[model samples]
Target: MEIVIINSSPRKNGNTAQLCDAFIKGAMQTLPKPKVTTVFLNDLKFKGCQSCFACKLKDSKRYGKCSLNDELSPILSAVNKADCLVLASPIYLMDVNSSAKAFLERLCFSLGSYEVGYRSLAPKEVIVVTIYTMNTTIEYSPVGAMDNVDAFLGHIFSTPRRLCAYNTYQFQDYSKYVVDVFDETEKLKYRDKEFPKDLLRAYDLGRDIATRL
Candidate 1:
């Protein structure tokens, strides 16, 4: 089985990446371990979909495929063949980061058809999962931020399994930064008390997904 994780965080070793690592670790423990691949969007040179409509051209060879040839092109092809596709992102301004949004646009827009029922033209059905990490608490976080993305993916593939880590630790030394909105002590306390639980949950989620696959 092939599992591809698209990490959209600029910080490679940030909270979002840590959760992905935990998930990978859990998935690795399962028998007949799946081949896991991690793609960092921040490291890639790509942009959102261009409205070329090549994929929508009837009877065209490029139908149902993105024509933009760039760094993300190969990744998109891999995801098309992957058994599981994980979108891992750190929330920015109450929504997924730019990279995640752009990636989704390129991936989904091509696969989603302009048919009568707005059918999906994907090569095969792939499992989808979204992992969100944010600095805001659960109550304050944008709960519906990913609704549209999930709906689009659901139409193309299946309803995704969503996971979130809230109130993430943003900075190593909060005092070094000029931010004064959050109490550093409280943030540290929460990270110390709850972050492990979040990681554990991520691990369990990965294990469960692997077993089902």
Candidate 2:
């Protein structure tokens, strides 16, 4: 089976990427060893769709494809060929990171046609992975971000699922807005203590999709 994993976090080895790695490790342990391709959005060059409607033109070679060509074409092509898509992002400002949003917008434009609904050109299973520092008990925490992902995935996939991680707010003092200063030891402690549980959940989700595929 083919699976495309999109990592949208700007920080290379941050908490979100670490969790994704764990989940991927678990998936690799399964039999048949699914073919997995991971694309890091921060490393790519791409822009959002401008709604030029150029993709709708008939007799155009670029029909159903974004006109503003960049690094997205190859990635989108791989996504179309994959059996499952994994969207992983670190929550920024209570939502997905800017790179992830731009990728999604351009992808939506490329995969959608004017005559039909916003269905993926190639039907596929979808799974979303979101990591955030907000407490889960709060109303507008990491879990709330799922709504945005759901709206996007529901439009693109016939079957969509999700896995989320919250409560990374290990910092004792939230009085200041300085995110620059973080305690690495504390972060590692938190990861060692809490991240494994979430990673296991994501692994199970991946296995479930693999079984169906």
Q: What are the per-residue Cα lDDT tens digits for candidate 2 across 1-213? A: 777888897766765676667667766767358888988898998887788877778898878777787898788888767777777877777788788888878777666656655446544454443334333334557555667666666666643566667656444454455655655566556667877787777777666666666
Number of clashing residue pairs, candidate 2: 0
Q: Positional deviation of 107 in candidate 1, in angstroms?
A: 0.3
User: Clashes in model 2: which pairs?
Assistant: none
* RMSD in order of candidates: 1.0, 4.1
Report lDDT per candidate. 0.91, 0.68
Ten residues in sequence with the least summed lDDT for candidate 1: 24-33
| lDDT tens per residue, model 1, 1-213 | 999999999999999999999888877777356899999999999989999999999999999999999999999999999988889999999889999999999999999999999989888899988899999999988778778778888888878988899999999999899988999999999999999999998888888888867
The local distance difference test score of model 1 is: 0.91
